[model samples]
Target chain A: MAQLTMVQALNKAIADEMERDSSVFCLGEDISDKDGGFGGAFAVTRGLYEKFGEERVLNTPISEILISGAAIGAAMVGSRPIADLQYGDFIFCMMDQLCNQAAKMCYMSGGQVKVPMVLRAPVGATQRGAQHAQSLEGFFTRVPGLKVICPATPYDAVGLLKTAIRDDNPVIVFEHKKLYGGKRVEAGAIAPVGEVPDKEYTIDFGKAEIKREGTDITIVANLLMMYRAMEAASHLEKEGISCEVIDPRTLVPFDFDTVIKSVKKTGRLMIVHEDTYSNGWGAEISAYVAEHAIYYLDAPIVRVTTYDTPIPFSPVLEDYVIPSTERIIESVRQLMDS
Target chain B: MEAKMLLEMYEQMDLIRTYEETLYYLFLEGIMPGSIHQSHGQEACAVGMLYGLRKTDYMASTHRPAGHDIAKGVSVKDMMCEMFGKEDGCCKGRGGAMHTGDITVGAIPANAIVGGNIPISTGIGLSLKMQKRDDVVVCFFGDGASNEGAFHEGLNGAAIWKLPVIFVCENNLYGASTSIKNTLNIEDIALRADSYGMPGEVVDGNDVLAVYAAAQRAITRARKGEGPTLLELKTYRIAGHSRSDGCAYRDDVEEAEWFARDPIELLKNKILKEKIADEQILADIHEKNEQIVNEAVDYAIEAKEPSVDDVLLNVYWEGD
Candidate 1:
């Protein structure tokens, strides 16, 4: 086992996949290392351009629409493509291609073609204001043909990216900006160091990882919120309240059984995410738990999510809007008391 | 182009026109299921552009897909079945009239969104280049699609990557009854290609030989790895954009002007004057094309609708 950052792990996964399959090439803006171009906006594609050459590690113009559409076309015609957008917010620019063409090509073609493409979009709020920062997994999760994954750890990032690259369908993998321990570090960025196995392994979709064990309540979270949930759990342990944490690796093929099992044991559940509170991913989790595991819940299911407002530039307002550990702790303590 | 190739283009154009006319007649009789964006007068554009293409070369079509689908060799029976929402459709009843296509013949599902298929064509070109394949992709769209943001994005990408794609914009004068004059600022949509660093050409879309010659030049340039070319064919759809359109936005004077230069008629006169084919031969070709359309209609009408269980399938592919 070797310790690696999330970005490093992702780079390794893409490099390995490209090496294993030549058809697996990357296309995005500023993804190349030549001509002083950044190896992607966050350095996730660093060294890949040098290693795989320009053809595989491609750098396109500022065109998310073309990038997504081209990737779908390539996938439809027997080539695998992994397209990346500089930010998750730009996903809207290519929504038609991502949602309509890439997502529906196989279904519309009657399974005659498979769009084996992965769209790597870095999500989550940082200092960047309304346009750049957004937890966009919720938007894409609603799209049926896409496999949406939110990886919170380096191990999960590496394995899941590998799986997404090889998967014979369109996969949207949302990597949190804070978890990317690259050279361009953001303020309040938590360094995620985890051991990645030396051999090739892939984690199946719809599987949830229990980050921590508990008996009183279950805290379901993903991406940056998963770290907050873990922090809240640790602080609650000092107060003699145990909170089990569940990280759903993927959203569409959600691991309801894992959350349901944990809820069945703990008899309480709390869902948290950085997406807006209204119609957020947390709401879906809450609805699912209510529908299937209502009897197991000792109290009503609660959701701790970002406020229904665009992310602001000021740190205070941003922190206040996004769900903090204090908010998660308060929500969990109140649920337990009830 | 050879005489045989020119004749093949004529037959393709005739087939597309007959298919569209049949669809229009069916719509008028209230027998068709969905609205159609018929490409009647613009037959030569699709036929000339696609006639020389290999079956494996890709084509990305728009809402007006009949002409491109016909020229691309899409199974007319399956296309008709798709329009009828039958079980054995090329799209298996999922994609209807506007989204008709068959991947077996290298037609990606026709994108309904305006300018949506441009980027997809660029991606196919990228794939072909990566796979070291000699195939080039031809993306068909209306004049208005040239104004979409995707049009700029896709063309810029194609130019930068030097992908093997020929963007064939059938500038049919109108976008859903809104004239191109109101939507575009440039004289020709081909001029907009200059901004993307690609050669742009405007061909007389009603002339099969002219359209075919232009397409052959662009396709040859693309296959030679020279890069993408924008071929804006100056054509017009003889019918309305969709089923409900009454041609109110268009005047009869304009209609008469275009009808006088109809592509099928242009080819028929040329064939007769040059003695390339006798009037009887041309008449027989028209009769054969009508029969093909009729047979497809019958086959599609006889096909069954998909079962409910199939609705849940193909959302995601299942594999190890």
Candidate 2:
């Protein structure tokens, strides 16, 4: 076993897949030095070009539509393409290609065609402002034909990415920039390094990871919010508040069973995310629990999320907008007191 | 070209026209469940470009795709059933008229979004080139798509990769009511290829032979690894953009002029002059096509509507 950042773990997963399957190739802006920039905005594909060469690790033009559309087309034929979108916001430019074309092809072709494609987008607020700091999993999760995977840990990042590559349908892997834990010599950085396994393994989708187990209340979160939930739980424990922290690693085929069981035992639930309050990923989980696990709940399911507004570039404003440890603790205390 | 090739092109154009006319009637009667973008006057472009294509070769179509789908050899019965939203349709009743397609028939569904299929077509061509296959892809789009960024990006990518693809812009004067003259700066859409360093050709779209000749040259260039060619078929749409309106925005004088240059009438005259088919034989072909169209409608109406469970079946492929 070896420690790896989420970015390193994603690189490992892509490298492993490309090495194992010749059909697996990556294309995106700044992927190859010969073609220009240095392997993506966050450098997740850093040094892949040296190992796989320029062909497999292709650097495409700054055309998001072409990048995603090409990936879909290649996947349609025989190749499995892993398209790296530098930021999640740019996905809006290629929405028709991804949402309409790639997602619907398999279903439209009556299962005769399968778009085995993976879209890697770095998301989360890191002082990048409204355009760059969006947690795009909420938008992608709403789409039916595409699989949405959000990994909070480096171990899960590597495992889930490998699984997504093998999935016959299109999968969008939303990586929180903060969780990648890569060293940023820039002005501001919120990265946290984590441990990952060197052995080949895969984290199955629709499975939640119990980060911290307690008897009183369950705090469900994902991505960056998962880390905040843990911090809140630790703080709550000091005050005799037993809190269980659970991270639903994937959002689409969500781990509803785990959340339901955790709620059944704890009899209280608080969902947290970075997306806006209205129609966020939390709404789906909350609606599901309300429908299926309402009788088990001893308190109303409280949702802690960002205010419905564009993420501000100012660090203080962004910090105030995102789900914070204090907010998680406050939501937990409210649910517990109820 | 051989006389048989000409006859085959004529037959393909006839099939496309008949299919559109059939769909038009079905849609008018409100028998068809969804709206349709009829390729009523765009038969020459589809048949001319696709008639020279191999079955393994690929093509991407615009919203008006019945013509291309038929020319690509997608069964008329399946398309009709799909329009009726029946279980036996090509897309299993999931895709309506705008999205109807059969990958098995080398026709990627007709994308309703402008320029949506352009980059996808380039990807298909890239796949063929990567696999060392000589298969060429013909991407059919409207003149409106020429202004789309995807068209520029896809063409540039195809040129750089030297992928075997033919970008066919069927400039039928209008894009869903907005005329090309208003949307585009340049008169000839094909001339835009100069920016991408590709050979651009403008052909008489109503003249089936001329369209076929241009397509043959472009397809040949692509097969020889000369990269893509932009073929702008200066054509006209005899019908409305969709089921909604009847070309009220279109100039009546211009409409009458294009009607005189109808691809079907032009092809019929050529067939008669070339002695390809006598009037009796042509009448017999018409009778047979009418019977076939009638049978397709009957099959579509009688076909079973998909069950509720069918919606969840093809969402993903489980190694099948």
Q: Name the regions of candidate 2 deviating beyond 4 angstroms.
A: A183-194
Instruction: For each candidate, report its DockQ versus the true two-chain complex.
Output: 0.77, 0.68
**B195-293, model 2: which lDDT tens digit per residue?**
889999999988888888999899999999899999999998888888787888988789889999999888888889989888787777777777888
Error of 1 at B225 (Å): 0.9
Please give, for residues A285-333, the per-residue lDDT of candidate 1 as tens digits.
Answer: 8898899989988899888988989999899999899899999999988
Clashing pairs in 2: none
Can you give the TM-score per candidate against the true fold? 0.98, 0.96
Report lDDT (CA) for all predictions: 0.89, 0.86
Tell me the deviation in Å of residue A287 in model 1: 1.0
- Indicate which candidate wins on DockQ: 1
Cα shift from native, residue A104, model 1 (Å): 1.2
TM-score, cand. 2: 0.96
* Model 1: per-residue Cα lDDT at residue A78: 80
Share of the reference A-B contacts seen in candidate 2: 0.62
Per-model tally of clashing residue pairs = 1, 0
Q: Name the best candidate (by TM-score).
A: 1
Please give the range of 10 consecutive residues that has the lowest summed lDDT in model 1 chain B.
B1-10
